[model samples]
Target: MIAITEGPINTQAVIDAVQADGAGAINVFIGTVRNQTQAKPVIQLDFEAYDSMAVKKMQEIANQAAERWPIQKVAIVHRKGTLQIGEAAVVIAVSTPHRKASFEACEYIIDTLKQVVPIWKKEKFEDGDVWVAAHP
Candidate 1:
């Protein structure tokens, strides 16, 4: 499952999507909106994405991870639009035959998605708002 939605992300659903009888380990990574950044108070966050391109890039990341690891299944879900503190922005789940592969693949998926996906984030602060770079 690879998706971009405006609503809240269901982390359990993501984990469930990647579950398989052959898999022994499932790793999940959740990226959430925090209350502060660089010691600055955060009000909220607004996310925008070239939906089609973002999804394509995300799928590419998943495919690459599968090639690198013995991944049984993978799910990548990202949320767009305004999000309050503690709300999930992204959830990535990976299942593999072993724990090490699951961990490595999950980490690679999130890291690569952040680098390649065309998702823009605007952090709303108490003072103002600024568009942050994909890496930052």
Candidate 2:
């Protein structure tokens, strides 16, 4: 599953969606807005996306993870628009019959998503803001 939401993400919902009877482990990775970057004091962030491309890219990451690992499920949820420091920006969950597969697939999805997704992040600082490569 994939989505671009304005409100905060539900972590429990993500875990529940990926769990299965045969799965022995579920790995979850959460990305948060940091307080600082490049030595600048960050106050918040504004995330923007080409919604159509973002969703397609997210699904592609999930499909790639599934094919590369022996996993039962994959879920990726990313938030858009304005977000404050410490807010959850993205969540990736993967469940498999073993711990290793779950871990590997979860990491793969996040790595690939960062590289390929069309999400742009504007880092808001006390003095000024700048747009940089996001989710990578």
Best candidate (score: TM-score)? 1
Model 2 per-residue lDDT at 6: 85
Alpha carbon lDDT of each predicted model:
0.95, 0.90
Per-residue error at 27 for model 1, in Å? 0.1
Error of 2 at 9 (Å): 0.5
- lDDT tens digits, residues 1-136, model 2? 7888889999889888998998999999999999999788899999988888999999988988888898898889999999998999999899999999998998888888888899999999888989997654
Task: Indicate the worst ten consecutive residues by lDDT in candidate 1.
Answer: 127-136
lDDT of 1 by residue, 21-120 (tens): 9999999999999999899999999999999999999999999999999999999999999999999999999999999999999999998898889999
Error of 2 at 70 (Å): 0.9
RMSD (Cα, Å) for all candidates, in order, is 0.7, 1.2
Model 1 CA RMSD to the hidden true structure, in angstroms: 0.7
